[model samples]
Target: MKVGVVTFPGSLDDVDAQRAVRLGGHEAVALWHGDHNLQGVDAVVLPGGFSYGDYLRCGAISRFSPVMTEVVEAAGRGMPVLGICNGFQILCESHLLPGALVRNQRQKFLCLDQRLRIERTDTPWTAAYAEGQEVVIALKNGEGSFVADTETLDRLEGEGQVVARYLGENPNGSLRDIAGVSNERGNVVGLMPHPEHSVEELCGTGTDGLGFFALATLAAEVFA
Candidate 1:
């Protein structure tokens, strides 16, 4: 399987996401934010960073990038799309996922090894994880709090769209401690934590995050 890792201006973890893809036994394709083409990749990953300098808001400017046009279309076709950190914000801004990412309750940037419980394993990116399993990953962000209306939150929870939740203390004060979520089709996922940074034991928190990339390989076969 070939996974495209998009590199937007100010993307800090695009290369790390590419490395994770390779370590998961798949090819990684470099994608440019300014390109409207997807280059025929099987899946797409929007890595973490302060895109467009977080100008108006986190991910506000980058959501209008040329590459996101292709990404939104591909995701609509059931192509697996994973967004991390600032990428998560982009997904929300693009309306690919529900809710909005707001500033932390304490109004401060946070960096830590966050423990998240795998809530839904049916998504293409989470199939390798067991339900209720806990995994630690690197998390760093200022506006990571997930907010949604009560009805929407209830609908997401009722439909099993909530993918992961913070296990310990809520680092960013996300509503319901949501660390991740998936679209109705389960192909598009937005996660606040940096799973790419956790794929290598020597570098990040641990290798627990490798499951996300590993399971994505099967999505190509399933969707093909």
Candidate 2:
């Protein structure tokens, strides 16, 4: 399996994400935000950080990155794409996922190892977990609150698009405590937590997040 991790300016987690992919037994390809090619990777990961220094808005500038055009097109064709943190914001900005991530309701950056419940394991990025499984991963960001119109929220819940929900407490006041979501096709997913950071147990967060990368590789195998 070959996984591409995009690095945008200020992207702090791209290297970590690539390491996670490599640890998951996949080839980790470094991708540039300015590149138009995906380098024939099997899947893509949008790592976290304050891209473009979070100017204008989190992920606003990154949504227009040259790579995003390919990402959007590939995702439309069922290529699995996982967007983490600021990447999640980009997914929403690109309309790859529903809802917008706003400033934390508390108006502060949050950093913690948060517990999350797997709500939709059928997506390509989450198939390694059973529904209702509990896993803890690192979460950190300044703008991580998820918001959408009432109808959109209801639709997401109704359509089973809610991929993961905060387990202990809502850290950012995300609606329904949503920590992650998948597109209707289930190929594209965006999550607020930093799964790439938790894939190494020596780092102390456990290997729970390893499943995310593993599952994407597995899905590629299954569909190949």
TM-scores across all candidates? 0.97, 0.97
TM-score of predicted model 2? Answer: 0.97
- Candidate 2 lDDT, tens digit per residue, 71-147? 99999989899999999999999999999999999998999989999999988789989999999999998899999
lDDT of each candidate versus the true structure: 0.93, 0.92
Best by lDDT: 1
Candidate 1, residue 206: the lDDT equals 89
Residue pairs with clashing backbones, model 2: none
Estimate the lDDT of model 1: 0.93
lDDT of 1 by residue, 29-62 (tens): 9999999999999899999998998899989999
Error of 1 at 211 (Å): 0.6
How many clashes does each candidate structure show, in the order listed?
A: 0, 0
Which 10 residues in a row give candidate 1 its minimum summed lDDT? 215-224
